[model samples]
Target: MSALVIQTMQPDFVESFHQALDAVARERRYLSMLEAPPLERLRDFVADLKHGNNPQFVAFDGARVVGWCDIRRHDREIHAHRGVLGMGIIDGYRGAGLGKRLIETTLAASWEIGLHRVELDAHADNTRAIRLYESVGFLREGVARDAVRIDGRFVDVIHMAILRG
Candidate 1:
């Protein structure tokens, strides 16, 4: 596997990022919640990065986008020290360590921006994602029962978080 180049996302990369995310969403049944935001929304999301409110990163394999992660700081004053994280990788790129790199890079960026903790939620049945989060030091916080309805079936969500030291 080629080494993934982890870097901050740029506005120009939005289309490719959306494409990669769409591919992942289609292949990973549990990631159906991942959706491509409209171009305007994506532009706004990218703009948020400039103000240090939303931090986004992309993993590239020689110019092709393979994975992406976003860590957005909470807007609530009481929760300002924390951020919510979201990640997705192309199906063909799984198990290649790209996810780990993407996550670690995002976490590092979060820490650099003064966030004390980062949280993420994944479908309970997504064992692969759970293991990846665990490997990166994110502890399972709790489960939200019947949190999401997918294809007429209810799926639980596992809340996980990692604190920066």
Candidate 2:
């Protein structure tokens, strides 16, 4: 892999980002989707993120998206101070500190935008991601038992959050 760079999500990255997302999702062990949503949906999603200045980032190798981290702010006024974070690194790039860089970059942007809280849920079995979240100051709030049923198996979901000072 070439030297990696992380940049805010942009309209031009929609297709590559969609491919990267689908690659991770198809693994069926990480993301909520078994496949990426429609390309048009992704295009609209990118447009919304860019227009709203939401904290969404893609880690790239040359022109290819190898990983991504995004914080989508709540739409309702009552919850506007908060956002839900999501991220993934393609198979080859795991354990190389790409996740850390992607997350920290996105979180810094979230703070910069005045978001008061950022939250996420991870599969209970994903201990590496859990540790990473803890290292970044996210505290475990609760466990949603059997929150996800995928491939005829059940997994608990760990809910966690970090607050901006």
Candidate 3:
């Protein structure tokens, strides 16, 4: 309803972040889980991310978190060039191009931080997300068959990646 503010996730915003994540997870469409962690656990995790080298971004509508995008790079030296991506948008925000903005901003930050490749996995049925990733130069790497189990059913996951040029 207000102008979206895109920025890095801050420690002070943990509770709102957790609630946004939990709400998105319950949607059972974009994410793989049906539940999210409790507030304290999420706070500690957020604290660690804030202190770590990984790059994470959040879209805020005034005080509420509307979307999030994060990329966690590998720790081992040989794999440090690669980072895994994850993101979600609230129900009211889909199809309005917020996802495109978030992914582009996160990838730009990832490249700036020396990441060479950013990877992500999406539910095969999530065409909207797949299109968003593809529009940003992500290529279909492969598919992990039945990689997610939800609502007593298994779903395929499409693995995609974008390599920095």
Candidate 4:
């Protein structure tokens, strides 16, 4: 693999990004999405992020996207200081500190855009992710019992957040 490059999302990355996201979502173990949305929809979503100045970062090895992290700010006036984060790393990239790099990059960008808080939900079974969130200063807020059904199996969701000064 070439040197891993992490950068803000750009138009040229659309297709590879979509493929990477779809691969992770299809794993059915971590993210809420059992499968990725259509490519056009993903394109629109990335456009919205760019237009809104929301933070979205993609990690790549040469031309292939390996992982991504994004934080979308709330639209309501009262919630404007907050953003929700979402991220995923493809199979081969999972435990090598890539998630840390992607998330911290996105979080720094989020703070720059005047967001004071960032939130995320993780599958209760994803302890590795939970620990990563904690390392980045996110505190566990609460858990929703059986909040989702994946593959006919109920899963609890842990809500967590981090506040910036």
RMSD of each: 1.7, 0.9, 1.0, 0.7
lDDT of 2 at 71: 94
Against the true structure, candidate 4 has what lDDT? 0.94
Clashing pairs in 1: none
Q: Write the per-residue lDDT of candidate 3 for residues 54-157, one digit (tens) a residue.
A: 78889999999999998888889999999999999998988998999999998998999999999999999999999999999999999999899888778899
Q: Pick the candidate with the highest lDDT.
A: 4
> Which of candidates 2 and 4 reaches a greater TM-score?
4
* Model 4 worst lDDT run, 10 consecutive residues: 1-10
Work out the TM-score per prediction: 0.92, 0.97, 0.96, 0.98
**Model 4 segments more than 4 A misplaced:** none
Residues 104-127, model 2: lDDT tens digits:
999999999889999999999999
TM-score of 4: 0.98
Tens-digit lDDT string for candidate 1 (31-128)? 64546667677677778865765678999887888999889999888999999998898877888788898898889989988999999999998899
Instruction: Give candidate 1 misplaced runs (Cα > 4 Å).
Output: 32-34
Of 2 and 3, the candidate ranking higher by lDDT? 2
**Cα RMSD (Å) between model 4 and the true structure?**
0.7
Better of 3 and 4 by lDDT: 4
